[model samples]
Target: MKLIFEKSVPGRCCALLPACDVPVRPLESRFARKDPPRLPELSEVDLSRHYTALAGRVHGVNDGFYPLGSCTMKYNPALHEELAALPGFAGVHPLQPQHTVQGCLEVLARAEALLCEVTGMEQMTFQPAAGAHGELTGLLLIKAYHRDRGDAARTKIIVPDSAHGTNPASASMAGFEVVNIPSAPDGCVDLEALRAAVGPDTAGLMLTNPNTLGLFDRNILQITRIVHEAGGLNYYDGANLNAVMGVARPGDMGFDVVHLNLHKTFSTPHGGGGPGSGAVGAGALLAPFLPAPRAAAAGGGYAFETPPKSIGTVKAFYGNFLVVVRALAYILTLGGDGLSEASENAVLNANYLKALLAPYAPPACAGVCMHEFVVTLERLKKETGVTALDVAKAMLDCGIHPPTMYFPLIVHEALMFEPTETESKETLDWAAAQITGILRRAAEDPQSLHAAPCTTPVGRPDEVAAARAPKLRYRFDTL
Candidate 1:
């Protein structure tokens, strides 16, 4: 396929506009650029075709199965999208008067209430824009709460080795020193290691229940108790909340602060970088320190309030508002019972896929998993010199988006798969068969796997080069 710029033809345009009706204002010399900007010139038909081709190249949940683990690449219902796109919700600006945007405010308030019920948190702020941002916001709340109590020496955040990388990054961003705790052989947090890590300097623990390895920690309550006993707050990274949505609540697990990935767990369109709603929820202790201008109940209506001891505004206006609308739509559409069923189906799909693929790529942990699970290609790699990357690339040839590769850091040649609730048994079976076939091919002819993904428009990107020196946009010289 040629770049759109390569297909550009001189003096070609879609439509000729009428003469300007308004008087034109000349720009000051200081405000004007020395050279006219260069852009691709193409006829309407050519431009449309070019973009249509590019769109086809972009694979999304709508395109096919996406089992990217820990990301919850599930199929969000289009109904939520339709509801979010309604003019009253989508057209309103944040700067609109409070009374005028009452409907928007009410929607936000209702969404917060539903999320609170699901997570068992007292108060929530839809400020932080993504899960990591939520993590940072939650940590800041912990920091403020501890400092307010004069426990200023508490500056360390304990994170398990099996946690999302964002866990430590968010902690560090919040100016807290991160203490790394190892995972036990069973892939849950090592309780003894956690115990050893906490002390006077410990501020909190940022944990992802049903962590990156996708195993729910049986010791979650005891884990939170240890932190609370040490005067450290517990922060729950609700990335894996899909596995336990209505099944359990983070607050019940004793977490002081929780951050939910509304985009992932809730039915919001995320990925390709966001427009995600992190939406931090807090237990009573951390509520006072939540980000400012939170939606609150006022008489029979909803109003925004900055908590007396707020950490100030974390975002301009509220969060990604439309994302909130979509999430809220999902909650209302599913209701309580449907939400629980979604969780159950998500867990069931994951376990079923894990069982099917066990022979080709054994899981990183024993026993059943929750919504997602990790499988390592250690044996396949040793026997066939086909690393996890090769298997992933081969999946592309099979018209399947690959599982997350080399993640959770702990698993060797990891391929984390999360066949979320939206996937059917037929889809799971096809994915399993594809993996099994790929592994067989890997063993029989490793070289072909190494050169896999011949089916895609571009094969075998120079990943290291692309990362270090990316050609992000088109340049005339590149042609």
Candidate 2:
């Protein structure tokens, strides 16, 4: 496959436009560029084929069993897409008069009500664009709430070592000093470490319920209680909410703020840099500090309502409105009862897959998992020089996308798998077979595992070089 630019032919045409009928407008002299931009010059057929080929090269939930742990790569329904594409919602303008877009406002207002109910939150804002964005927004709310009450000393946010990398990053970006707490041997929060970490400067604790290792922290309530007792707000990461949705909730566990990944848990198109909705939720304590332009009901009609001491607009014109539409559709379609079943099924599928693969690839934790599981290849790596990466690349050769590799930091040579609820038992069995086959191959022919993924179009590149010196765009000189 050649680069699109490489296929460009001089003066090649696509007939994308008609001759201008109106008066030709010239760019202002200051805004004009010295040279015309060079782009891929291809016929319409060539362009279509290029993208089609590109799409085939990628692996998505539609393509295979995508068990990327902590990232719920489930199969989102097509109905949600149709709902998002509805003209009434998709065509609405942010600058339109509030009274004119009642349907759009109602969509958000209804979504807020239902989502708040689901999470046990008093209020929510569909203002943050992504999960990490929501984390920053939620933290800012905590910061604003404390400062509003004259507790400015609440400056440090406690995060468990098992938290998503974005947790500490979001806290730091929100201008809060982050305090790291270690996880206990059982993969839950180390209670004593958390207790020792909290003090007068404590602002909050940020964590997910079922952590990255896919074990639901048995001490979740106790963990949140310890923070609250120490005068710190609890911020739920909500990344693992897929494991507990409807079955459990962060608000019930005493979290003050939470950021739900609508793209992940709520059956929306995810990955490849998304138009995602983080959709921050808050308890009564932090509701007033939610981001502004929140949808509300005024009399019989819906309208935008800013909270009293809001953190202000997190994103211009309510974050990723169409994404919210898709998410809201998912919530409504499943409803409460269906959501509980989905969560339970998610747990069941993960545990089933873990059981199938446990003999070949041992899980990092014992007993049943919540909605995902981790397998460590430390012993395998030592015995056969076949690291987790080797097994992952080997799976790619088997026409399967590998689970998340070397993550959560604690487990050596880690591979985390989330067999989302959408996967059929047959699919799980097949995936397990493929993985176990790869593990067998890993030991039988370690050299082949070292040079795994022989079937992929591109295999075994200088990863470090690619990362450190990425060639992000085409170079005119190369052309």
Candidate 3:
């Protein structure tokens, strides 16, 4: 469990250099650094074992149940990775000529078309690098569309209290004043509140259908209609689209803009700070304002085209190419029916797991949940001093990654769980059992739950102190 640098041996070095194939050029004086960086020195075997041990400590979908709630931690197919690793997709340089990268362009074009068909959008741009990035891109599109028509007065965006934290942040980042609305008694948008909130300055309403509460709003159409009727637009947050995928279309629901999390609904998840794609899709209303150089069908082959009044480049180039490659392969492999089935299974898994845990910890809302559910330990905390954080820490000892803790900010002591379609019934059963055991421990020995997770290499950390005074590196006095 030592740090990589701690294991460094001064005399050791990895055998990496090959004999000079040609002439070796020395660096000029101005271009060279006076002292070399202090990097770990180790033999090949030493480096291999260090990383292998680190890998073993990590938890992922392949390791065990990963019901991460709003973040759908579904299992990706091996085939998607294989396809992305192909030479034509992986080897092509971003600056390659149009004719030379036909196959790559085709991947973009085909994915755009299929995704548009799924979301009921007219066009898409793989420019945004992540979901929040896509949210900004989509917001810019809405802002441009309104400004183009001399409707500069529309400078506000409405967001529900149950929305992802990024929704209001994205709106604010896009220079729109965010108007917050409260959720109704049933965890859906409060219609009356939304009705009163829209006005001359209303740019749009940013919402996630089957929202962060894990409930589909039956009033979605009416909600979107209200924004359109008010001379504003509706922006769909596709972070939770896995709950409805082929079951419904956001465009048909009257939304004009949507930012899809390719990592969430699509197979190429960018967990742990991975490279990701958050392709934005728009209806005809905002299509012309989309980011530039999207794959377009050009005569016999494909070509890149910028929209008439494009918002310009969002990223340096077309989004994480390998991520897009993996996503396209996932969609093609699943097809229409398979995608629909995947959504259905996702819903089923969530509901099934919710039922098992309902006896121990009541859910935040009543009735059916879509692809995820939130359970509150408020009552347990009040009765036994065992908060959601204690229960989550207890889960680590059970060898399970705990559900999202204290999220959505609506419910007190909230723990959200999303057992995606990829999980089996047995896995769900075991996770429920582990959680139930934790609940029993909370009731029987409240003090013990406070010091839970006794088995991990590292125990609970002082997160607030760590954030404020972070120990950023190893203490090497004389490197």
- What tens digits encode model 1's per-residue C-alpha lDDT throughout 234-305? 999999999998899999999988999999999798857798999999999999998889877898877889
lDDT string for model 3 (1-479, tens) is 88899999888997788989999898798999988888989999998999899988888777888788888889977787888889988899988999999998999999999999999999999989999999999999999999999998999999998888899999999999999999985569999999999998999999999888899999999999999999999999998999998999999999998988888899785557667788999999999999988899999999998899999998897988788888988998899998999999999999999999999999999999999999999999999999999999999888888899998788999999998999999998988998998898888999889998799878888899989988788879945
- Candidate 2's displacement at residue 181, Å, is 1.0
Q: Would you estimate the TM-scores of all the predictions?
A: 0.96, 0.97, 0.97
- Predicted structure 3: lDDT: 0.91
Q: Give the clash count for each candidate.
A: 0, 0, 1
Where does model 1 exceed 4 Å of error?
Answer: 9-22, 468-470
The CA lDDT of each predicted structure is 0.91, 0.90, 0.91
lDDT of 2 by residue, 365-477 (tens): 99989999999999999889999999999888887888899997999999999988999999999998998988988888999888888988788889899899998888879
RMSD of each: 1.8, 1.4, 1.5
Tell me the spans in candidate 3 whose CA falls farther than 4 Å from its real position: 19-22
| lDDT at residue 398 of model 1 (Cα atoms) | 87
User: Which residue pairs come into collision in candidate 2?
Assistant: none
lDDT of 2 at 253: 86
Model 2 per-residue lDDT at 212: 87
Q: C-alpha displacement of 423 in model 1, angstroms?
A: 0.9
Q: Which portions of model 2 show Cα errors greater than 4 Å?
A: none
State the lDDT at 248 in candidate 3: 97
